[model samples]
Target: LACAFMVMSGYCELTSVSSFDAGSFSSKIVTLESIQIFTTHEWLPAKPTLYFLCQGGNRTGLPDVKKVDFLYTFNGDESWQPLTELPERKCKRCGLYEEDQIKSDDVFDEWELCPGDFVDGKYVHFKEKEFNATFACPLCKPLEEGSPSSASKNEATAHGMNVALVIVISALVSIVVISGAAVGYKYWQKKKREQEQARFLKLFEDGDDIEDELSLGNTL
Candidate 1:
């Protein structure tokens, strides 16, 4: 029996900007350095989660991002948790201040994002590499040597096979072209020899009278 399948596509994009402003309690605008819009497609079967990819330093009144915070939701329902977590990770005197009282300045130059696998939420964002947690993400399995991510390794393998196939096909084409050129050169030489022989025979078929007349004139 013949089976058929249908495919559908969906897309979503998230951009990291230098700043975001929410005015009148609703509309928001993200400001960045001159990139109009960056887009990524989300497949129907695999809905890729949109991460903010926020690094640098926290402009929001959150804990020093280097110390604790990583993925932060600024305006929506996860707003309070994002703001509170920052202050909690501060020094005792620093923690006592209310979240609103905290200054929104860049601090701690060496904040580092924990190595994380993005697909399937296997590793929590900003979770330490040597963390004391179970490997829950489908994409975060320990590969032996070459494979990077579960999905990334498969992609790399497929691309490598494609490149190998192209090289093989190109080599075959080059061989065929060189062989064709050699055969063509032999055919051209044979045709030139045949034309010369035909011309020589025509001179004799026209008789030696024309040749004799030319010789007699030269002698006179």
Candidate 2:
């Protein structure tokens, strides 16, 4: 589709293309109308990535789009027309640039699983032995596959096991210490009782000799 847009705003005006020679191009004469810009933020590689939608039907005839080239012209200067070729990767999951800076203004943003695929499209890219592309909304990115949820669960389980083991070991150590203290205290108390009985027996024997001597003196 041929479209024209005002350089100031990002809106594109719809234009029709007719058959013509290779050098000569035909365009429908339509008045320019001002429209709102439709700018979207896509997660590309560290380098800039281009996006395109397929315009072919299913399984029968594949689209003849061999490669995509992005053409850019500056706001006022039409002299410099830059063309860039799209770079292909083994998998879209590789070389993804993570967005950590300021967030976008839109509350609901679509996330494509692959790098080059557009949002809300069904023809997701896949690899034979490598990871495949999966699309997710902005809200769903946090809970997507290989996220922190599984790791967090594993950490929690490990923490709980450690806590339980610590509690059990503490209880066993306290029981052993308290039992040893009780046995030592009982032994000390038994030795004290035996020493007191021995002292009483010694005093009784000494007093019996004095009583016998006083009886003999009274008889004399």
Candidate 3:
């Protein structure tokens, strides 16, 4: 018995506008830029628990801002977490903040995401004065040395595999088609031979009957 495997696909995405220069307050604000969406299928056999690991930063190394706040929203859920865990290591100089100055404490304490706020579907949207972003787990790919780069490579590899799979599928289909044509040709040849044999037998019987008729007439 052959055991079949089902393809259970899933993915997460992150979107942000171009990086903002938060200056010395870089750690205080994530350069708000673009928003992203995440989607995935939930298999019946194994349901996975989802977790969010979020991060932010400023591109400039200038003196960080005095204080910054961060806001977040999630799909189908009202109100966002004031503060979420950073995706990367914490900077020793900034304490709770990641390098570039986006501090975890300021966001949770100062940010306000009152009513009628939602991130929209399997995604966590981070919004701030200078920083706006969104994240999801399943759709998140890994970066070359980190989650971001690895994620991109994974997508490229998956695409290549899909292309190879299509080629293999086409080859198998061609083989099946060729085999069917050969079988049909053999069947046609067998039927033609049978018809020829029948025709020859009918002619032989007619000739015998004619000879019998001649003999009878002569005797008469």
Candidate 4:
């Protein structure tokens, strides 16, 4: 299996802005512009075949590097070669590695490749003991500003949603309060009616006892 370690240092700057697909803002092409190897990591004197590897097991082989400490530039022919497509919001694990015949491939360096890391559509990654490389993507750009009307529309929509949620919550609370008040009033009325009935029954019982006493006194 191929492997790589992370150690990066480079300078990147944006020089121009280019239009990209509206449907796929995150997707942008990555191309290799140049690379200079510091150490080939070989035991014998031999040319090293290098390749780029990224997430999802994507690989692209580069031209064989003939010498160390020498800068190799790619012409327009290789400029069109797509190394990978990177997303603006997410980073992909990518690296350079040497192809090996007897064992697993040796890693030069690996790092999280992110479109956001590019300044002015270009990024340079350098590992002190391994290699220094430059990658370019003409279409990669910073977040573009939308029209004022669009921003206003989005804000208005969000405000309207908040208002609707408040209205719904208020309506529910009012309904619960009204229902509770109605139940309390009904309970009060029932209690009052029961008290009135109890008072009337007591008066009737007292009248019957008084009549019985008067009848008994008259008999005596």
Which candidate comes out best when scored by lDDT? 4
Give per-model TM-scores: 0.29, 0.33, 0.34, 0.51
Better of 2 and 4 by TM-score: 4
Error of 3 at 131 (Å): 49
Q: Order of all candidates by TM-score, from best down to worst?
A: 4, 3, 2, 1
Alpha carbon lDDT of each predicted model: 0.35, 0.36, 0.39, 0.78
lDDT of 1 by residue, 1-220 (tens): 1222222111111111212222222221121111111221322333222222133333333222222123222232334222111111121111111121124421221222222322342333122331121113222223334434435657878899999999999999999999999999999999999999999898887778788888999999
Candidate 2: regions farther than 4 A off: 1-147
* TM-score for candidate 2, residues paired by index: 0.33
- Worst lDDT 10-window in candidate 2: 27-36
lDDT computed for candidate 2: 0.36
Off by over 4 Å in 3: 1-146
Tell me the spans in candidate 1 whose CA falls farther than 4 Å from its real position: 1-148, 207-220
Count of clashes, each model? 3, 0, 37, 2
Query: Which window of 10 residues has the lowest lDDT sum in candidate 3?
Result: 7-16
- Which candidate, 2 or 4, has the higher lDDT? 4
Over 1-220, each residue of candidate 4 has an lDDT whose tens digit, in order, gives 1222222111111212223344444458788888899988667677888889997967898874668899988752573367888765566899999987778999999898866557788889999889999888776754434745345546878999999999999999999999999999999999999999999999999999999999999999
Q: Could you tell me how far off, in angstroms, the CA of residue 43 lies in candidate 2 after the best superposition?
A: 57
Q: TM-score for model 1?
A: 0.29
